[model samples]
Structures are given as C-alpha cells and as structure tokens.
Target: MPTYISAVFNKDTRTVEFTADNGDKLIRSGGSLAWLLNNPGNLRPGGKYAKMIGQADTKSGKFAIFPTAEDGRAEKRALLRRKYNDMTLYNAMHTYAPESENDTAAYLAYVRKRSGATDQTVIKDMTDEQFNGMIAAMEQYEGFNAKPETRKERIVHATQVTLSDGARPMPATPVIVRSSNTGEKKVTTNEHGALPTFITRQPGEVIELFLEESGKIGSRIGQFALQQASASLVFARNMMTVGGNSQPHTPTQPSKEKRTPLRYVVQPGDTLASIASRFKTSVDDLVSNNHIRNRNRIYPGHVVWIYGKAPADAANDGAPATPTRSRQASYSVRSGDTLSRIADRHHTSVDALMAANPSISNANRINPGQKITLPVGVEAVPPSAAGSSRRAGNSGNPQTSDRPSLVKPPPETPAAAVRPPASVQARDTRSREGEGHPIAIIPFSQKRAPWVEHAYAQARKWAGKKEAEISRTINFHSELGYGKQFTTLAGSSNAWCASFVNWCLRTAGYAISSPHPYRARSFAADTTRFSQIDEPVFGAVALVGTSHVGFVYAMDRGRPVLLGGNQSDQINFVRFNPATLRYYVPKSYLPFAQKELKETKLDELAATDLNAALGIVVAKKAGDNTR
Candidate 1:
C-alpha cells in the first residue's frame, strides 16, 4: 500500500502519496503542525511520536539532519561525514538494507517542502543512516575504521515543474505554467499539494521565483547553484573474492602465551556467555574463535569453542601448559561480519577493533577468514561469568540448539551443500531483498517491568527528529526487522533491541560501538555506559537482557526499559531486563532485521547530560584498563 504525507507548511496542508518501501510503517502520521524544539535528531525512530519503524530500505544511502539553522557549510560537512561512514556500514553492519545508495539533505524541510533557511529556529528531521555515516567518517579520521561511513548526494531540484489548470492561486486553480531555459515550458501550482510557482534553476542556468504572494523573494534552495554531487565509491570485485578480504590485520597486544581449548557440541539451551565462563575465558575470545553470525541464535548440535582443553601432543607425551595466560584463541573473520559487528560479538568497543586491526579501514570491508588479530583487553561481565552456570553443569558451548537439530532435507537448507562450520562464520549473508529476507535474534529478557515505559519514552524522544522510525516500525510488524542481551541468551531469531538503543544514543551525539551479542543484560546511556556497560552506545540501539531494544530514556533499578517496534504484535513500550525476567519465543521463522537504511551518517544530536541531572558519571571508570 502507498503511504501519504499529509504534511502542512506555513498553514496549508496537502497529501502527497508516494510509494513506501516494504518495511516502512506509519507509526505516527504527521499532523498539520509540529513544533521545532530540542534536539530534533533525538526524536528519531524510537524517539518521537511521529515516526516510522525503520529506514527507507533503499539501494544504499545516507541521511543528515542539521539544525534548520545550520549554514550551508555545516550541512556539507555533515554530508561528508555520512559519506565516509557509508563506505563501511553499508557493507558491514546487519541492518535492514545494506550496500544500497542514498541521497542526503541537511534537514527534512529540504526534502519534504521547499523551505529555505536563514538562521531559522524551526525544527527539521534526519535519519539514523545519516547520523551513523557522519560519525563513522569522523571515527575514521580519528583512526577508528572498523565501521563504515554514510554516503549521500548533494541535494538537487530538477529544473522542471508540473502544469497547473491556471494561476489564479485559488484552491481549485492553484497551478501555473512557466518557461524554462531549454525554451520549454513547465508548470507549477500553488495548490494544496504544490509549491508556489517558482523557477529554481540548475547550476549554469537561470531561475526566477515569481511569487504569487508579495514580499517572497526567492533564490537557490541548495548548492545546485554551483556544486556537483558527491562521487560514489567504486569497486573492482566482490570484496570477499577480491584480494581486499585477506588483509593481514594484527592484534593490539603482542602474542600471548597459548590458552587451552574449550570445545562443546552445543547442548540444548546453552549460550555463548555460559560457555565462556565455563572455560574460564571471555566472551570476546569465544566470539573471535567461534565467529558466531548472531549471538542470540546458537543452535543445538552446533560446535562452539572456549578455552580450556590442551593442545595436541606433538610426541604423544607433551603436557599441556597452564591455560590462564592466553585462555582463548580464534578465527577473526566470519561470514556476514564487519569489524564493528565482530567487535560487538567480542563485547569490545569499535575502538578496540581499530586498535587490533589498524590496517583495516574504518570504512573498509573484511572477508571470511580474514585472519584478524584479537585483543585480550577488558574482561566481560555476563551474569554467568561468575560461575553459576558451571555449578549447574550447563556451561559447555555445544548445547542442543532447538532449531530442528536433525539436518534439514538436502533441498530444505540453503547452506547444507556448503557444510557450514559450527557457529564460527566467515561469509557475507546480507542481501538486498527485504521483508522476505531478514535476519533476527532471540528475544532476551530483562529483570524489571517498568523498563518498558522508560524504553517507550526514550524512543519517542529520538523519533521526533529522525525520519527512519516510521519505516522501522512498519518493517518489524511485517517480520522484516529484529535486539538486547537477555534476549540474546534467552533466545532470539535475530533480536536487535540493544542495537536499536545504541543507535538512539549515537543520533543524540554520543559516541559508542555495538555491544557484543553474547551479552545477557544492559542499562541506559550514562557516564556508566562507556564505563560500566561493556558495549556500544547509539540512540535507538538496544541493551541486551535489558527490556527489548527501543529507546532508553533513563535508568531505574540498574536496568533499562525500552520502547521498540515489533515485540509480539505492534510497536510500543515494554519493560525488559538483563537478568532473564521475560522472553518472546519466535513462533516461526519470518524474515527479520531486513531492510537497513542507506549508510553511516553524521549530524548527531546534543543529548541531555544524564550526569548533571542525576549526579552520576557516564563514562568508563577512571581506573579501568582501556585501550
């Protein structure tokens, strides 16, 4: 079905129906008026009342929301940032749409209406892809390149117009016809759906805005006055098949002593964190070694590895050394993984990935078996890391996955002919098809109920400024989207609640990486996020085991509540926990987390300072071991 934007500008409303990509949902239909207040970007998906569920699900693109007041230079800078990030994310992250192209504008008004800016205090909108791309590009400049950047075109208006019945400017005769530099005639209207007759020209041509109303002189709306659009990235081959995939990425620290091997054929309900603790290792070691596709979807009979077993005896008499030092080892590249995703799998921040693989571009792509070096940096803090699972004899990695362990009939499985390695993936599974082809995670539970309210409030807050929320909401309801840690462990088809919350924070001007999925729980963004919480931070990204992924407005009882799309039935607020309080088992395999937005973008928001309001620090502890 087609969606229409019955939007109003300057006290007039019109309904313009355009084709909406499959997953784009109409969460909050726009009204006749919206106030321009606080950080508009904060009002993105999972943030504002007027939102869509996800990105537009295009080929590849970027969105950048500047304050409608930001001058042309700043908007350009933001676009540059998004463009750089797109180079990485469109290829790496597992969003709904990947590897597609997109166009960009400084503010929503640029696309929705032909509004010009002049130090105006009016509100505007942007998208997650726009913010992610800009930040990714910035991170690359700062030497953090595991993730990709955003890409978009300089805004352009065709040198054309639609013919109107006549130009009396009444509700009925609202359109007008005008002549063009091409010696051709074009038409425009002052109708409810049309902008007033104006001749906005392309570069090297001419434009004249013959205002039907007096005192409305017009000029160029964008640099179409004198600039060419940004260039698109060129590729030589499929990166995986090309030589780019096998770059020699080195670890941050020098080689450490050999760690023991911990092997487990997945048992029923076994999780990544549980296996890591059982072998006295870290989640990172497990993720690096295992190359898990999604942390929440481990299956029974799939072999997962940890560090505890001895090396093969060379002479059949050699004794195994103590495994305490190294504790774990692994294959870095996996199918469908990028540096950021890989970093998240290991529970480390993106900076750590850059530290280890300095040679990889923050905007670069990595291939399966890319031989990336892992860092033995910060230790993880999963609930089971304290040994409760081992005491129950449930710590092995090879647990019985519930996903129909009997191998599917040869024709029934897509990867069957390939004999996939257990968990440790190393190929690209992302595709262009949406709704019909999506990735999802298990639904982990949190410890509290009110988390849902908090999550909802937070999500609405971000949606106010972002344009992606509508699409994300619509997609999730359609089985084309996916979040959080508890859900990761509790079980998921491909949950991205945590990822959603993280997206929110980033949109609101916080720098964060995606959390590793072996996680079981998480909290709201605060100084503690970079410090206590061991994961990424982005507005709309989820915290595991916290409630489901959505928005994190604030924290209560050390848990995060969320407002998200597609929990069981619709998009709404729900409390979640990292301590396994609740869960939603997928009834059947439906495509999920499918259509991603364009690419990484810049144009971040200025998030409210939680520390000043609540008197708590928001960054990592002062003395913690960090890279």
Candidate 2:
C-alpha cells in the first residue's frame, strides 16, 4: 500500500494522471475531480456543484493533487499513465465552476425557448371532443340541474377541464350542476375548488344567462376558454411522457441541501464498482449520474460525488470541506519535445495543449521552458505539500516572433506515447510461433488469444447495450493513417483489421477506456444486444487477405456468412478460413480505444474478393460465459 501527499499548482479540465508511491499512474479529470469530490453529489459545503456559470480570471485556471492508494491498489499504474496519453483531448483547458445568476438568466431563456413555453402559448384550438361534449351537456338537461355526483351518468365521460389559476377578478370558482328530476339542481365544487361550479338548466335558462353575461352570445368565447383549459390539461397530463429527461425543466444547480451522499477522490485503479461499494451506492447510480459508460475505468486525483449518499451519514464520514475551483493557463512551444511527450506528462494531448496555449505556433517547435502562457486553474493542495519531480525549471529563452510561440525543448521520442497499446500482447503472441511456414502461418485459436471462448461474455454484454432501433450488425471502415502518434491509445491493431472492429465498437457507446474490467470486440456493439441476428448486419467487417473483416449473416454450413472488404478488388464477403488466415473480431472497442484507432484511419485497405475462397465453421468453445 502506498500513501503520500502532494500539491497541484495548476490544472485544466483535462484528466490528471500522477505516479503513486508504487510508481503506478493514477488519473482523474481535472474538472470532474474538482467538481465531484468537493461535494460528492450533494448541496452541502463539500458537495454542491450545480452548474458551471462563468469563467473567472478569464483564464479559468485549474488545480491539482497528490495521488496515492494501495493499501492494495488497482491496475498497473502504467495503464493509468496509458489512459492519460490516450484520451487527453476529451477534456477542456478551462476548469468548470458554479455559474452566477447572470450566467443562468440567458440560459434559462434558452431553455424556455427550447421547451416552446417562453410566452406560455397554450395549444388551444378546441377539438371535436370538446364541441361534442358541450352539445351532449345541452341535450342532457331538459330543465333542472344536479351535481356531478348526483347525475354522474349525465357527464361521466366528459373530459375534465380546468380553469387557469391566474384568471382576473378572482372570484370563488363556480360549482358544477347537472339536470335533475326536480326544480332544485345539485351542485359540486368547481374545477378550481370553489362552489356553484357551473349552471345547469334548460336551453331557455342557458340562453338567458348567456345574454346576461354577454348581450349577444357567450358560447363562442366560453367555448374557446374551455378548449384552452382542456388543451392545457391534456398537455400537462402528457408531460410525463417526455423521454430522456433528468429533470422536469432544467436541473436546478445542485445544492448543499440536496447534495450527493458521499464524496470520493479517485484512487489509482479505482473502477466504478469499487468506488460505488465504498460509498454504499450502486455502480449504476454512479455511472448514470456521471455519464460514465465505461464501468471499469476511473482516474486518480479526481473527485466523485456519491449522489446516493445520505447527509448525516456523509457527515459522520467526516468528509473534507468544500474545495474551491479555478481555471488553467496553457503553454504552446516550438520543437524541442514533440507535443506527445509533453502532453503525456501533463496527462493531456498536443491538440489540447495547443488549444490551451492558442498563441503558440502549432508548427511544433519549442525551446526549453519558454513561457507559452497557459490557461489553467489552481489545483487544491494538501495541508502539507509533497516533493515534486519532472522535467521542470527552464526560464529565459529567445523568441523570434511576437505572435504566441511554443516553448521549444530538445526533441525526444516518447516511448509510452508512440508505443502501440497492445504491442506487448502482440509480441507475446508472435513469440509462440514455432517457425513461420510462409508469411506467419498460424491456426485459429492458437498463438495469442484465439478470440473464441474468452470473448463470449463481452460479446453477450455488448448485444444487450445496443438500442433496438439501430441495426444490430457491425460494420468496418479501414482507413489507415497516423496523425495520432506518440500517445498511448487503446483497442484495435497497429497495422490493420483489429483496429477497424475496435473503431466501430467505440462509436456505438459499448466501449469505454479502462485499464481493467473487460473488453471484447465481438460484443462491443451492445452489452445487452442479443437476438439471433438474421441478416449480415450493418457496420460488420468482411476481411479478404489471410486476414479480413466482415459482418455475419446467416450461418452457411455453420460458417458465419458475412459482408466485408477486400479479396482482390471491390468490397464484398468471401469466406473466413480459420485454417489458413487469422481474423480479428472485437467485443468492445471503448471510446478511448477507438479514439486511438481513429488516429490510424486508413483511406483504403485491401480490396474485398468475392470469388469463393475457403470458409470453415467453428463451434463455440466449452466454458464460455454466454451471458
């Protein structure tokens, strides 16, 4: 177990990664950590993070922390460091803080506009239902009146309507009356809860009252108001049907009073399940509230709010006082160190660093420690500061131009960044080959992982996660290229095939970056998606070479009939021969993994061959977790 204290000088919304005493890199988002840990999903002094209203200090500075864990830590810290390198660009340079009333005013207006209720325009063109109801009411009463309760049959099916609460001259609400056998009619409370709700009499009495209220006619205007009221009533009834809503209107900024149950600072290797257990909350709540799709991943030095935590209990836990938030400053530099290396240390990306340090030249050169002006927030420091180590301390460097230029450092290839994510796995698998017969002759389910039984669980899980409306099939687009270099990226293969399948899964939301938990390309489409797919589904890959990509259709003699790319020419499905070629199928190409794979998007891969090659059927391996 490792425990140490450290301080943060500055930060941004980017996820922060730091080495634990065990030399394991832990990560947590600069923005989410600061926001979540402070209150941990509550409105109290420590948990209230309602909305990010505005940026102060204009720079919107950031803060940071010292990371430690291992009283039995999580996954390899190298992996945490890897995560920082892979998904650095998913964050913002500016750390978020609570919004002020002024910031909210404009947004509130925007919300109202989107809701189609800025001016309270009620949908009120009366439909035939209302007109017919009025006619029925007229026909029912020959002369006298009775209350709804007494003459329930008369108006039992009439759609109930309500009067606007803000009606002027606010008299007591009128009562409702229906025709009765005697001269005396029965009355019930009005829709507004007052007495003598409505008058019920013969046509002569109704006309007389109408004439008295309005000399000419009252039916037209009264009917319109009734229609308006009914429309409002119906609309209100249907309000609950609005889908995908977190709140009725807009979510009011979270407050200390309605704060999260507990606040947790991410330890290295902490996954959603681990933290949820610590706080006595379900993993679902944690992921759902935080919008975290990947259950296995979490960054260190970040804060999390257990929205389900109870106040008194949280207080009993003696959580820390609320932490303040700030912004961050950035520096762009000229060519000394490639952006990859620098971004890695900071747990960010060259693209992000560039965005933060806008004034710096993007042309990529920087002298040592040249002040490139950064936009960052001041990180929260522990009561006692700890030791610091990194490539630091360079001042005074010559700048040839006035426009923002990057601080140039000596160029160095970042091994962590440039190295392929699964390179080690690939190397291990390749080492097992006794000797290459031709060009890497290997059997299916041999060498490395055969992508068989081990992937079943992930495949099943992914099937469940996909929406029914979207096509259940998988597709592959092999656009190979290399802008995303010198960064630790996830999923996919370095050269081809595997990366393509990984890319599709990431786009579909089934995958999320994680040093641990689980991932499977074959099941990456949806965690819950499983329904005996019939057609060769969309987005599936059809590979041609000894290696190819394709989507599966019906089983032709047990072979996965598929649609895919490349044999000798155009894109089409040929067949998969396990005896001859190696085909890579993935279950989950998490977001970070796909983002990394996207870096190598190829314009075109090998052409898909249609001429029948050889296709073989493989049975499910025993002991596979089908669910």
Candidate 3:
C-alpha cells in the first residue's frame, strides 16, 4: 500500500510541493499534477505514480504519490472547508456572476452547469472538488486572487451631478474619487449625470470626492466610508434657480394668520399656567392653540399663542395698543429696567406691557429715558369676574377693575460694578496648533517647536548609519553618565529604539521621565500625557506595537516616513505601512526648549544627582506625592 500525503498548489511558481513523514521533499509541476489528476490508473511498480519525464528514485520506504482520484479528493475537501465558508462562497458567486439580461436566472444556470446538476442543486450538495473548481473559475473571471488584497479599492455605486442653477443635469462634470489607502481616480459624468463605476472597493474604507467645472480647480464635495454595496450621492451648489426660470428662487411668504398670531412672548420665570392666567385663559387653550409639543419646554423669548380675546386696542392691526389714562400708566425706563423687572414691579405680565408699548422693539434693550405704556390694574382678576371679564375681553372690551395694573413706580439708576484689569484675568495657555480647525486652515509652513526641530536635526545627523555607528554613538553618550541614567530607568540589554528617541528628545532640551524615556511600552502607556492623533505629524513619535518607536519625518504615499534606530540594524529613513502604526505621540506635549534646565548646569551634575533632580521634576509634573 502507498502512503498518501497532502500537497499545496503554489500559484506563483505553478508547482505542487509535498512533504513526507521522513522529511523528503516531493516536487511536481502543475501540468504533471493535472495529468495525474485526469489519469489515475498509471501507477509504477514501486506503488508510486511514475514521473512523466524523470527517473524514479527507489530509496527504502520512500513515499509515493497516490492517484488524486483515490486520495487527493479527500485532501481537497478538507482544504476547501478550512479556506472558505458557505457565505464567502455565495458572496463570491454573487459578485462575479456573469452579466446578463436576467442576472439571477443566469447565475443559477451558471452554478448548475458548473456543479453538473439540476437547477435546484444547492452549493452544499456539490462535491468539494466541484465547488473549488467553480470558485477558481469565478476568481479568474473577476481578475482577482482567492485572497483579498490588503490595500483598499474604491467602488462607485452612484453619482448625480446637477448644475448650479439646478435647471438641468451637469453633464460632463469632472469627478475625482480618492482613497487614502489606494490612491485616486477621475471620471466625468455622462449625459444623464450618472458616474461610471471606476473600481471595486472594500467596505469600511474612506473615500473623498471632488467636483470641478470650467477652468476652476475641484472643490471637495464630501468624504464618506464605503459602508454599503451601493452608494447614492448628489452634488449641487447652494444657490439654484426656481424651476427653469431665469430669476433666483425666493422662499414663499407665510399666510397672514400665521404671520400675525395673537401671541405672548414668554418672559423669564413664566410658565404655561402663568401665561394663561395673565391672558385670562386656560392652559389647555394655550396648548391647543399653539400646538405646543411640550408644555414645560416653553422658554423665555418663545412666543405662545393666546386663543381668547386680546385687549380692544390690541385688535388694531397687530400694533401695540395706545393706553388711555384710564386703562394705563407711563413708566420711565431706567438703567437695568428689564421687561421682566418692570413686569414684576408693576404686578403685571411682560406680555401686557408689550401689548401697550409696541414702539419698544426689543424688550431687553429699553433705554433709560424711553417711555413705555403699562396695562394698569389688569393682571388682578377676582374669582367671580374671571369668566365674564374674559368673555368681555374676548369681545374686544373689558372692565378696568377686572384685571391687574401693569403700571409701576419709575425705575432708579443702577450702580455699576468694578472689574479687574486685563492682566489679572485668567487665560488658557494650551497650544492650539492643528486643533479645532479644518485641516486646510493649518498652514503647511507653520512653525514647529524649537525642541522638535532640534530633535529632528539630531536624528538627521546620523541618518544612513548602521548599528555599529549607532552603538558607538550610544556608548559615547553613555560614558558621559547618560548610559548610567538610562540603565537606572530601563533594564540592561533591552531594545534601544525607544532609548534612542528619548535620548534625542533629552539632548534637544525636552525633559523625559523614567520608564517612558527608556522602555517603548512604558512610553506608549503614557497615552494620557500625549495627544493621540490619527494622522502622522512631522517630529511626532510613532509607536509600532509596544516595542518599536521612531520620529515621523513625513508622509510618503499615504504611509509614515520614519527616522529611527534599530530598524534593520541601522539608523535610516524608512517608509512604514500606516496599518502598522499603533499610536502617534504628539510633540506638543513636550516642554519648550527655553523651559528646560540650562545646559551648563546639566553638564556639571553627576549621574546620581541628575537622576534625583529628574525624579523630583517628574513627580511635580505628575502631581505625585513626593513624601
């Protein structure tokens, strides 16, 4: 009996390689494997499938290839199960199915033919070899490999571009779609204002679209993620003409009744019941008349409708009623004479005074000498006269004694409070660079901190140097007591990538603390102290995993260009995939160079003295208990 072994098909080399238990390597071309697959009965005398063109080696207990029909089928079945699930297979079929008038029916027919079964045959019913062959054919047709690419692709689902006037579709409008991970593509709209599919994209990747016309450069329309199988977007200007008319569109005017409602502008501390009481109406009437969504949500300055009759003078074309001596009193507005304050003093509602003084445009801005009319003895209503007086008021007239007086004593001048000088006022000092503003608002030529520039300058001096040179430099700095300080901070023989970053920072006048300035993991763990940004910034420390650290020099082709040591045993600039980046430690967290200890003073300190001083400074920065 011959022993059967599992084999892997290498698509790149076009060869099949298998390993036996005795560590012997067996090799065969893809063409030979295909032949053996088709012809299974041609076994050699040594119980091995004879090579098509090579002599067979008759070593003791040497493994031989069994016919695929007898053994390879089982191995292929297991491989398929491990590589693809049912959903993945179905999705691939759906994505790569043939284009036809009736796609669903055509896809079913294709699957049936490939599986060699009836139309009703399900994928689960097909043999593993049949499923694998069908998938392979589909992949080839789609022009993609079995495994998806790590980089993202852009898939345009739908686009609709319209003219600035919106009178017609914007045909031939140039559109650009860019993926940060996969570059960009440009296309123009067709006559129907529809964008053509440019590329296949994976879901969750972000894409930005830009539109251009005439000789003007493109403006960004929007940025969105490819979350669905299809996306529908429309790009249009803010201003547009009405229909096809030459005139610019204008909003329609509201109806007269809606424009002029019998409303009371709410005052501070006024509630639904208080408003209704002042209007001599019920809360239910107020709620129903205004369609108030929430009775308790009415705030000061909000206008609420009054369903019942307003004063007789209030009926004169929405103008404030001129109060006669019998019904009102004049009050002089003094400093700090708010409508609410006047209303409270006169035992009347702000609505009543507003109804009497229509000349006062803003109730809150009444000048000290401005004369305002007040409803006198109107807010107070006896229980017996409430209903009848309300009815009379609704009839456009009411007894003077029925309501409370809105009149009050003239307001007096208010004393002004003294203020502190500008120098004594507290202010925020946090650096606002690259924050609270659009990315475009930040200038490309913005100045960096002195320490950041110095750190980058130091790193650039050793660029392209290998481990020996880096080690020699490290030893030179260590002999000056820096090595003893670092060893006390981090253990010996540890990876020195983070140590190099800290050394550059410290040499450039940044004060780095224990654990962090030595260990990469500890530095990454101090996330709260440093701002974590999504995009890499120049001179910022880039953390890869919890081990490697480097300074981001620039962005090259959507990846971080890093300058760090211990990368391939060298201090060189290298491009790292954005996916490998774990965190970006912002340079803004480091103190300015001018704020660091003087270099002459630092040079005189011993290793122990420097460590003790650093510990005290670290504790103070962290607000730790020194005792």
Structural similarity to truth (TM-score) of each candidate: 0.19, 0.18, 0.22
Model 1: weakest 10-residue lDDT segment is: 587-596
Error of 2 at 398 (Å): 34
lDDT of 3 by residue, 489-590 (tens): 222343567756755554333323221244565454332123344555445678877667777654555666665655555444556677878554322232
Clashes of each: 165, 129, 12
Error of 3 at 21 (Å): 51
Output the number of the TM-score-best candidate: 3
Tell me the deviation in Å of residue 499 in model 1.
3.3
Total backbone clashes of model 1? 165
Instruction: Report the Cα lDDT for residue 85, model 1.
Output: 33
Candidate 3: residue 626 Cα off by (Å): 42
- Model 3: per-residue Cα lDDT at residue 246: 19
Candidate 1 global CA lDDT score? 0.28
Residues 1-627 of candidate 1 have per-residue lDDT tens digits of: 222211111111111111112111122223211111111222221211222211111112212111221221243344334433343322222221223322222222232232222222212232455444433332232222221232111222222121111111111111112223433222222111122212223444432222222322222111112112111110011001111122123324333334335345543335787766544467777777666656755533234555543235311110122212221234346576555444333334333444445575432357886876554322222221212211212111100011110111112111101111222232211122121232222112111121232333333333322223333332211111122112221123434444443332322222222123211243321111222212212122444345344443233344543345333322333344546332221101000100011221212211222222222222222363110
Stretches > 4 Å off in candidate 2: 1-338, 341-480, 483-546, 578-627
Error of 3 at 388 (Å): 76
Q: Per-residue lDDT of 505-618 in model 2, one digit per residue for the tens?
A: 332222211110112232221111111111222232333342344443223343444432221122223334434222222221111122323442211111121112111112
**lDDT, candidate 1, residue 110?**
34
lDDT of each: 0.28, 0.26, 0.39
Task: Give the winner by lDDT: 1 or 2.
Answer: 1
